[model samples]
Target: MVDILRADARVGNKTYTSATVVIIGAGISGMCMAIDLIKRNNCHNFVILEKSSGVGGTWHDNKYPGCCCDVASILYSYSFEQYPKWSREYPGQEELLKYLIHVAEKYGLYKYIRFNSEAKEARWDEEEKKWRISVEVSGDKDSQFASSYILNSDFLASAVGQLNVPREPDIPGLKDFQGRMMHSARWDWTYNFENKRIAIIGNGATSAQIVPEVAKVASHLTVYQRTPNWVMPRLDTAVSPLQQALLTYVPPLRMRKRSLAMDFRESFYAAVSDAKSDFAQQIREWCVEGLRTQLANKPELWEKLTPNYSPGCKRLIISDDIYPALARENVDLETRRISRITETGIQIEGGTSQEYDLIVLATGFKTVEFMYPIQIYGSNGRPLSDIWKEGASAYHGVTVEDLPNFGMFYGPNTNLGHNSIILMIEAQSRYLNAILGEVLRARAKGKTLSVRPNPDALKRYNRELQEVLAKSSFADSNCSSWYKTEEGKITNNWSGTVVDYQRNLSQVRWSDYVVEGSAKGVVEPRKITHLGRVREESYMSNGSLILTAASVLAVVGGVLLRGSSLLRSR
Candidate 1:
């Protein structure tokens, strides 16, 4: 793994910088992969290409008002480094970003990350058994011209998970009639909303969070909704100082809290995966009851806000303030189809129009397009765009068939509907680490190795995956979602529970893959000192078993009475 090669490449006069592995994106997935490589494999010959200036991927990109995670902080964070200092049940964007930065600094991952560097293209070189990656580096004040460089690596992995690219709706005359138009992801924080007549499009999770905050200042706000979603209460609460102290001192108590939160979140999988199950019925009832009680006086708004389709068809919106915000006298919920965008405002289908000073697009993202805009040339120089023309598909949402020795973090059919995505990312990191570790072991003996998923295995896995998903609420024809393609193929989200995905990817089955090449001379593998593992263990101080037992009883009693500050309701 330590074999570093540099050569004058054909593309410009620049030389190639080679590493054992080249990972794309420095988000949660990338950071976790780097940490596992050091902890589990004891490998440091890797480079992370981050397009942004910072490390916290989505959290860094999106800074809209009231932006917060719906999942509980305990389950949302990494398993190895559980955070006991979260200020709230559901963490806000700022807190989450700080946590990510803290983890990156603790692991010393900043040295491996190259900021302002975007991976443009990657081509597999069959003869050399390496991937030649082309990266575009944005010019800084010191540099006069932007430059490109070449990086060669034995293994290539994409940590560019879903939800990076913001989606701009194809509305007619949008560009012509735009009045201070901005997407929610790229919010203009400097712009003032006081006394401004605002129009926000889309009513998804992002919109739910933005409405309440924007409504407080806007003179009038119009929410254009094509379809209503099942909105549930967040029931968020702050963590008291006493609770934080208990969690900080009693490490075992924190462990139990996280375990309980994970199990509770995992149990909701049945409600999402099986739409007709008892769990689904119970959730639907709770949402309906909550909606009616919240909007009791304004009974007419209940019918307009309730969804006709089954629950879990699209992403669920969890908020306790959206209803009250929409009920404000200055706000209007427009259900009519948008005919077009005029110079001043949106034109309804009935030829009526309302002027607005600003338009905020809460449109979600290009989720189905995984690793898009990145030209990937796989085996025999086949372009990834042409290969996935129908829709993106991967074996267990990790390795592709033609893309040898390439693994993706959050690929197709890997997004969760009811559980934390951090779980899926951790599973993929471990799987890739296992595979890459073996490849390095073979390289020590002067052997070149290449591995790709078996064609039959890829076919069978996707077939079974889609078969199970077809019965889920996501496949309902009445609803359209980012989880599916334009052709109605369910390309995103797993078919089963989080536990199922973890168990399936627990170990790599060499039989399900086509492994090539053999080792030549008998050379001993490099002995790696497990210093990083020891350091990680030392970082988390554990108390004695007797003390931990006593603390658990005391902390558990207080948590039960105070309603478990770490847990939040849906």
Candidate 2:
């Protein structure tokens, strides 16, 4: 019920603004948080600051060709907000973007999103128990240096995912490439690849889709591969008009469709968790057979495209057209490592050289680096990056140990190899909403609060998670992948299924978090918990009373029945 926030002090003639909650990024995580805050909590004293001009986070930024989700559309979306009109099974980038826009509009989230506002620094103020957030506001032509503003907030939430920043490989003379250069993440759609000899570097997840799509139009295509990936056929199909109509008219059908899709995805978790499992071998064989069937005549090509590591070690690519595209006469697979990039072409090992009009860096983004470009200082001004110097680890993959009242979706070890992350995100948003509710109550009483997981608990949780991951294919594959850091630790994947994550985050364990607030020092701490909306003792008393009455009634009925039977026997 507390809506008022202490006003921000004026700095350099710029009036700073303060909100109850300041969510960073307008991506799926941020939007989900915003919607939960408004709809469930009926709290709206928040703002979502996005670096991009539009609402869709990655979908808004990466406008590359053949961009589509690896997960199915029905399950990839929020369970509460189902889209009845997904055009494809695995929707393309544009369609996905459109879906996001539709969701944002439907939820009336546009007014809450502040676009082109990039967060620069967020420092926790211990004394004030608030976050001093510095943001760079672009597109302000009237103001010099674009506009640097401070956002003071009672709580800070990060939906800024780890995958947007594109990384180019460290190849010598990469700058010397005089031909058209582009990254798959930062795709240049305007620059024509049609009728041009194009070379794609790094045959990973993004390249798996880009290669085949580009081959359909490029004059010639060459893929430079260091390590091959296991690619299974994508069961992609267009949604017929009848199906779309059924989904639109019969809303429950979407839930059923998502449940069926989830079942298919969940069945792969065993294969992902245990590399030596029968299902894992079957997955490997499926990839091998897929290659053999597509490149039957070109046995040599199959050998080159085959992966050397376990199937789930690296992210798998699902594309039906990849092998067929590679088998084309104009398409060439270069397994040899690149020696250097020339002005017009690339030189490979053994003195082999090739010319191409365009070079596509299909390299992926920094996955282990959480919240890059934004420096966050937690309690006591300890830098978040420094605290996570070894690797990023979070309790329940949502809250870190030192970061108080700051929650993140898709944090360390939350990325699922088998199931859709939307499921995980839904659970996380709900959990964070509970934490926010607690914060709001404290603020309503004119008190400050800082919330974080206990250090011992986080350490134990992460240790158990790492042990589980050790048996998973990602750790046993013996291949360097984006899932790990330079230390070769599995930091990007969850050791369990999405359902596991959901059940764990279904409710906030108030005892698990180390709470700090003004009420504890002088006044008694608030006995607030979401356990059936009643005190623990009260709930136990009601249950015990009901059980006692039931026991007495059963005893009386048994005596009466015994007496009647004795008389009848006589």
Candidate 3:
């Protein structure tokens, strides 16, 4: 085994004006990747490129009423770093944003992040062994790149997730609508809905969140639902101060809580992956019973609210508030087909027209197109958009077949229906940390290295994944969701359990990839290092890149061990 740097070991806090590694976004995934690189890999020569004015990708962007995380707060947070004092079981967007900002502050990440810097294009520099990235920022429009900035790096990590981009439904006469309009993702906070007749369209997760809260305040809330979703009651409660005290005093207690939450969340795997299982049937009953119990007063709701398909066919919504809110006198749930947006209001298919002062499109994101509009040119000048013309895919939801020295966070087929995505991100971070260490280590040795998995390996991985997913409710059940591609392929989710993903990304199989260096052809990353001894992997050699000896620490598991956290999860 190659001697590697011990994870969690204290490394140099050096800063690089020009980064050797460039991360696309400063969101949760990007921050996690950067922290791992600096702390675990002992490399600090990286910068995060963020388009917004601050950190927090989805959390910062979405400030709509009742916007929050559905996953349990304790489990959703970073395992290694936990904020045990979360106010709720599931946190609101503001609280989540605060958590991300706190994480950045704790790790000293503000200096390394360039806010308002949006990546436009990335092209591989075959000769230079680097990526030439173009970015657009607030600058002189008449500049060299026409208001865009240039950044060059040896490696790139696309941490931009699929949910950020806002999409509107294509309805006839949309521009003719005279009322104020906005999408859920881009909620207009300044434009108040108080005493305003609000027509909220779409019934996805965002809609489910907004309807309940908006109904309480709006003069009249009209929700246009095309499909009914299987719902699970959320156990959201304020965290008691005593509980916070216990969590603060007892670190292991918080760990146990997180583990328990994860276990409970993971139980849904059967419902989504193996819909015919007993547990899946139990879940279906629970959803049905819960809806019936909540809407018992208005028994007529069973006809309007009940879904036709199975529970796990579509994304299972977790909300304890939706039923009561929709059942209110001022709230009207209309299942009629929307004909078009008129100058004053909406016209239903039954020739009925309802006028409203404002229209809130609860329509969710365009999730199938991963990293849209961001042009990434791989080897042989093949644009990533052209390659993913059919759909987006990756070897292990991280590395693409020909995108050498490039990786993505929250890429295709990586979204989870059963558990937290933060877990997947951490696993991928460690995996990428290993590869990044190898690449930079090689560069310090006066060698330029390029890395990517074999084409056959990537193909085999995705094919096996699709075959297994075909049996699941996500593919088998007839329901339209953000999970599928334009071609109706289940392209947005992981078919396997969270533990499975954790195990797969635990280690980077050196032989599975193809790597070459300028000075040394077929550069093998395997090296000589002793886990039981002391050494440093890389260091400054007279202000130039140079590989230093590896230093080891006495960890419970050996240094550079893969999937240690995954083992903890088990």
Candidate 4:
């Protein structure tokens, strides 16, 4: 229940503002942390720095055609704030963005968010015992007050999750292209693709979602595939009015929907984690069935579209349209390696050049490079980039060894392969909220506090984590994924299931962190009871499974009674 907000200090031309907490992003992670700060910790003195003009993080940035989530809509959203009226089973980018905006407005977090403020550098001040963040503020053209300033905070929470920065391929002559070029993340909707030849550079998940829509409008579409991906059928269906009403009125129906998706994803862990398992083979068959069946007529493109590595090596793609789109007469699948880009188009390895009117780069993001382009210095002026020179590692992917009073959302090894990341984010939010609450308590008593993960704890945790990750399909030597570094270290995905991550972060282990100054040091471990809220609602008293079954029976019984009455009348 402590609030500290001041802007009294000024040195030369630079101004300094202080806050109890500073969250660097207005995405789901940052918003989740802000809401937790308000509800859990009762702390309101925080500022969220967002580089974009709006919220939604990745959803806000990537506004391409046919862009939608692979996960089920019911389970993809926040557990507490459920949306019963999703248009489709798999919601698109706009719907997701609307959900985020609605949540932010409901929580009244807009007052604390600085839309165009970007954190460039964050350095720990040993003397001041706080984090001094160098923030650069930029405004749109025709607007004034674009400047840079210094902000100090008692605790720094980096909610700038991965997938923010778009990665363009390092191909030669990329700049020499005279035609219109754009990355999938930065789509230009204004440009008309009708009756124009278009070339898509990558065939990953983003491209998988984009190809279908582009193929419809373009005169001719060429998809440049370096390596094919495992694609399963997306059972996307419209949520009818009846279903929406049931979800809205009967709360159990909504819980049941999420529970079903969660259970299925939980069972899907073996498919991604252990590629040799029966579940993995089953998944492979489903993917193969979808691919072969969709492109059955185009036998020539079968081998070209088949993956060389295992199904789960790279991120899995769930789409029913990508294959059929590629099978279109105007669409061509190019498996040949690209040599370089020409002024007009792309040149492949055999010196075969193809002209195109537009080029789309779907080369994804700099995922392994956690928090890149933002220099962060911790204890002893130790650079965080240098510390993670080999690979990024953190204790539970939240607290680092030397970075005291700092927590990261969706950090290294926290990304999920089989389940929704909202679960993980909530867990990390609760854990960080506990630490920040301790900081607030210290501040209430006129004291400064810093708490960082114990080096030994971090080391041990990562050692065990890497060991488990080594056994996963992501460690396959046959294929390279964005999950790994150039030196072959897995840094992006969690080694276990979402449930495992939740259990690991369910308790705040005080002994695992180093406390500084006047702070709550080691204490008996306390369980965050609310951490079990989601699972409890799914499996416990609500009895989502039983309710789901009873609801099905009720509908069946109603139909039978109606049928009997009709027969008697006849």
> How far in Å is the alpha carbon of 383 misplaced in model 1?
1.3
Q: Which scores greater on TM-score, model 1 or model 3?
A: 1
Every candidate's lDDT: 0.83, 0.82, 0.81, 0.86
Which runs of model 4 end up more than 4 angstroms from their true locations? 1-16, 140-143, 520-533, 536-570
Tens-digit per-residue lDDT, 293-321, candidate 4: 99999988777777777667899998889
| Residue range 1-570, candidate 2, lDDT tens digits | 522452211111222367878899888989989888887677767878888789888898888778899999987788678888889889999998898898899988887777878899999998998889998888866236558888888889999877888888999999998889998877877898899999999998788888888998999999999988889898899999899987786554555577678878988988777888999899999999889998997998877788788888888888978888898888998888899999989999888888889999988898888888789999899998887999999999889878888999888998888888777777788888888777777777787778888898899999999988888788864688888888888888988977677767766666677888874442224344442211111223435555755676688789999999999999
- For model 1, residues 207-249, the per-residue Cα lDDT tens digits are 9999999999999999999899988788888988888887787
**lDDT of residue 56 for candidate 4:** 91
**Colliding residue pairs in candidate 1:** none
What CA root-mean-square deviation does each model show from the true structure?
Answer: 7.8, 10.4, 10.8, 5.6
Tell me, by TM-score, which candidate is best. 4
On lDDT, the leading prediction is 4
Ranking by lDDT: 4, 1, 2, 3
How many collisions between residues are there in candidate 2?
0
- List clashing residue pairs in candidate 4: none
